[model samples]
Target: MTSAPALEQPVSTAESAEPELPTPVVAPESLSVKFNDVGRAFGGRTVLRNVTMTVNPGEVVAILGASGCGKSTLLRAVGGLDVGFTGELLIGDRAVSRYDERTAVGFQEPRLLPWRSIRRNIELGLPRDLEKSAGKARVDELLDLVGLSDRAHLRPREISGGMAQRASLARALARQPGVLLLDEPFGALDALTRLKMQDLLMDVHASTGTTVLLVTHDVNEAMQLADRILLLGCPDSDPAEGATVKSLVTVPGTRPRNRASQDLARLGSQLYAGLGVDSH
Candidate 1:
């Protein structure tokens, strides 16, 4: 993973006592998500079972678990990508039976088109009916939002993995999705890059207030990003059994949190234990 550049700070002048602050951009109201006893199976083998949860509007929720614990499956259910699942999965007031413009999904891979420039790639996320000029403006705005304005003309191959991931995030938000579904988006990055991505995600979330449902196996990633962490696991050690919610942990404090705080450390220990891992 590439080292993340330090976040730029405002430079003060001798004549000016304070630096100018950018106006806050309030994101539009986001939609809520609801899962009612959701379950999925393949070849008579269950993967998810009786998984029910509610993600309030504008909330950042993380679904976490061990490998094959069905966390990604649950997120796919919300995105209407996994139609094989049973039970009701709702985004806002509508059932998640078809692709809805209100939602957007970002996968573990950047999935960018090498042939297209970064700006053009992001434009792919815009609504088909949007006017050409409007789409261009939207694309430009998103490029700036993700801090890729300078690299707009570059192709995906020309950028670092971290920058490419940032572009992927910009593409997801290009439509101004009410709910963003992420499936281990930062999992491919190294530890340092992952930390940088998490910080960038928080900054974006605060600016847009878009609802986020992130699926990740890293406990620290979930703890650092989510308002609440939903732990999924099977009742038995067998993989044939379906997974369900094992526990729901609410991370204390507000945004721009201290990851190494004692409170978070204690909570992390408990979460580790909940995953059946030895805390020591």
Candidate 2:
């Protein structure tokens, strides 16, 4: 039998160095929220200080790190939940003084009203000018988007955890907020359910293109979801010297990711390294 020629292997040399790959570029604009030398204190205890960073419009920024890293506190400050801080906090070219409906926070829990049906919960974000039919239509559409259209008439207590969270997301979107803040929204769910919710969140982002800022202790979760990961370490020795932006790592992986894949593993390792943690 005649032998076929073997394929030649490329030689590795100093010239090869590291192969450069194209990176996705996002345009820079005025900060959605800018914290300049911002500091916060409470009862002689400081939770954050000199923490500065800009949240871009239509950007998905995930804050990830250990507990007590002040990630949640920073989110609260930007959302105008914490007014004890001193510094500049600009939200879409405007200073944040009072909490505006334009910024909506979706917490770990669904927090839906049991007395009201899923439709009512979703319509809560609509304005008074929205007529009953319009509001109902919006609700029905959101329910369809969340894959819970048939459950619109069901109460919060009647739905599953995943379904409830889907309803919560629909309600949050119904407001048409420019900025959406999520604080470990899937933290309370089981591993499988959490994964499902993560996919759903990504789907929503793909369709709505809403600016999302999520806070989570799970490094892998941050790597899988955020376009940019913002690490906030714990406050320093002095209360005045509070938590700051440890690092901002850009995640350039494709969506609908496989958590077990090597790319995700490398990304998680990088995130851990950003937190000053040694990973195996």
Top candidate on TM-score is: 1
Model 2 deviation from the true structure expressed as Cα RMSD, one decimal place: 12.4
Candidate maximizing lDDT: 1
| lDDT per residue as tens, model 2, 244-277 | 7778878866676676888778878887876768
Rate residue 130 of model 2 by lDDT: 66
TM-score of each: 0.89, 0.82
Instruction: Enumerate clash totals for all models, in the order shown.
Output: 0, 0
Residue pairs in clash, model 1: none
lDDT of each: 0.86, 0.77
Please give the TM-score that candidate 1 achieves against the real structure.
Answer: 0.89
lDDT of 1 at 229: 96
